[model samples]
Target: MSSLYLLHKPYRMLSQFTDSEGRATLADVIDVPGVYAAGRLDYDSEGLLLLSDDGALIHRIAHPRHKQPKTYWVQLEGQMDESALKALRSGINLKDGPTRPAKARLMTPPALAPREPAIDPKRHPSTCWLELTISEGRNRQVRRMTAHVGFPTLRLIRASIGAWQLGDLQPGEWRRETLHAPRPAKSAKRSGKPTATRPRRHS
Candidate 1:
């Protein structure tokens, strides 16, 4: 049977199941075997991450060719502007190549918990938030794009990937579901507490 796990990863946690540095890992919480993460979230990022035992589904979720859009609530270091939004909505030229057009909108912050060690206010920089959805999965693409447009990102929380969402899961919480199994309408969410919060993009 194939398995899927939706985990709300907290910040500064590794996405791998194990680490030689003795840092907190997925094995610290996920007791199950034979399942691997479909994608990886960055160590510095926080939000929904998916793991699965189904290889094909993992490929579909992680492959850029599939064009599964990723959504994030981003806190910018300074104010947002029309020019920046236009550039992002169109495409941002990065070192590698130009990104595809995205669904970009400036938004008020979402209701989320504070980071364990809060962002420093000493810099006295104004901050704005944006909800960005992109189909292309690149390394630090969202942050790089925002910074490319002259607004450095202060915080980034991924809200959902394709059809999956963070929903009501809190930090370190996880829910498991098996697609092949039959179920009633309500029996979907499973619970776990894992250290990793960053789900990876297609790599």
Candidate 2:
């Protein structure tokens, strides 16, 4: 059986174990040997990051083809309008290409622990929070989406991925669980081909 770990990756920390630049890395927080991060979380973004020793599980979670949904709590630099939210929900044409439609909505500021070297209120006086959920994992996609809609993201926090949530895990804290094999896909009636399905999502 494989081992799975849910970690609250802190801001300004690299996802990998080593950093030649001497910046903080996962080794500072996670001491487990042989386990590797399934997907990357930006050094500046803080939130839930999944790590595991199971190569197959890592592939399923990290591969864009799997389309595992990831939700973020975004702090935008300006007031959010319905048009912006609608555009986000509809999809935005980015430099990489048009993104998939995402679940976007205005949310009240969440009560989150202040990050070290928090966003200076002087630089960004007015801001609003947004809850954005997307199935694709692109490099800085959340930040780009908000920027394209005229609202720059001042801060971003990934709230959940698929069925796993950050919950009450504090910075640098991690929880471990045993992995289980996924259910086999059911065969289609006409084609006799297996239909793809993922684990149930978090409510």
Candidate 3:
């Protein structure tokens, strides 16, 4: 069986093991050798990051073509309304391209400890906390999307990727898990009526 690791990556830690400047990395938190991060999370972002020794498994998880959904708890600069949610659900055009329509919805702020160093205060007064979920993992995609819609993201915490969730794992903690091939979901039967499938677009 292949080896897998789940790490709650803390802010300011590099995603890779080797850093020339001696910055903190997975090497600092996990002693497990031969495992590599499946995908990268920005050094400023905090949350669950998966690592594996199996190259094929890593490719499957990190490749955008696989379409594995990643969920995040985003704290926005203002109160989110239906229009913003709709915009996210429809699609957001970025410099990279148009992002795939996501499963966007407004959710109550999850119960959790306050951030150590709170997010930067807004220049203009605004509300806090808006949950955003996206299937595509583009480079700083969530931040750009919210900003494009006039709401800059204050903080981003990834809650899950595919079948793995952060759960109660605190920042800087690491755990090992066994990974298996994900089961494919059943597809709906075709009908005479034309069907609408969300187009695959780059973020």
Candidate 4:
């Protein structure tokens, strides 16, 4: 059995265990040894984060090729129109490349504790919430996507990743789950002769 940790990572905490700059890190919240973050949340972002001791599980969760859907509750600085939602659903051409189509829609504000340093109302007089889901993992992708469509993200909180939900865990709180490691697919055997099979491409 493998150990998986679901942590409600707090805002302004580094994803890693150590930081030379004396910033808050995972070590401050989680005391688990041997397990590492499967995927990273930006230091300024908050919400669910998965950690595991199994390398295969970590790869499956973190790799973009796996296409695990990550859902976020995004607070935008301004109201986002339908046209912008449609654009996000279509695709956004980013500096790295064109992103895959995503699911975006207006949503009611979530009932959660206020951030330590909350957004200033004066800086953003009008704000709206959006429920956005994307399969691909890119560095700062969610923020960039919204900014590209003219609605800058003021706050980002991941609600779920694949089937894992944030649930009732409060900031800095964590829970552990045990899971069987994923088994690799076996190669097909031919009756007459050994046939060569091309490796599957991740893309």
Best by TM-score: 2
Per-model tally of clashing residue pairs: 7, 0, 0, 0
lDDT of each: 0.82, 0.87, 0.79, 0.87
Q: Candidate 3 has which clashing residue pairs, if any?
A: none
- 46-152: candidate 2 lDDT, tens digit per residue: 99999988889899899989888999999999899999999999999999999999999999898787989999999999999999999998899999999999999
Stretches of candidate 2 above 4 Å error?
Answer: 182-203
Q: Supply the global lDDT for candidate 3.
A: 0.79
Candidate 4 lDDT by residue in tens digits, 1-203 = 56778888899999999999999999988887898999899999999999988998899889888899999999998899999999999998999999999999999999887899999999889999999999988899999999999999999999999988887777888887776433455533322222222221211
lDDT of 4: 0.87
Residue 125, candidate 2: C-alpha displacement in angstroms? 1.0
What's the TM-score of each model vs. the native? 0.85, 0.88, 0.83, 0.88
Compose the digit string of candidate 1's lDDT tens values, residues 1-203: 45678887788877888888887676665666887877888888988888887888799789879899999999888888999999999997899999999999999779897888788878845888999999987899999999999999888888999988987777777877655543455654542333333432211
Task: Tell how far residue 95 is off in model 2, in angstroms.
Answer: 1.4
Tens-place lDDT digits, model 3, residues 50-93: 88899998998999899889998888888887898899999989
Give the least accurate 10-residue stretch of model 3, judged by summed lDDT: 194-203
Residue 156 C-alpha lDDT in model 2: 91
**Per-residue error (Å), model 2, residue 103:** 0.3
Compare the candidates by lDDT and give the number of the best one. Answer: 4
Sort the candidates on lDDT, descending order.
4, 2, 1, 3
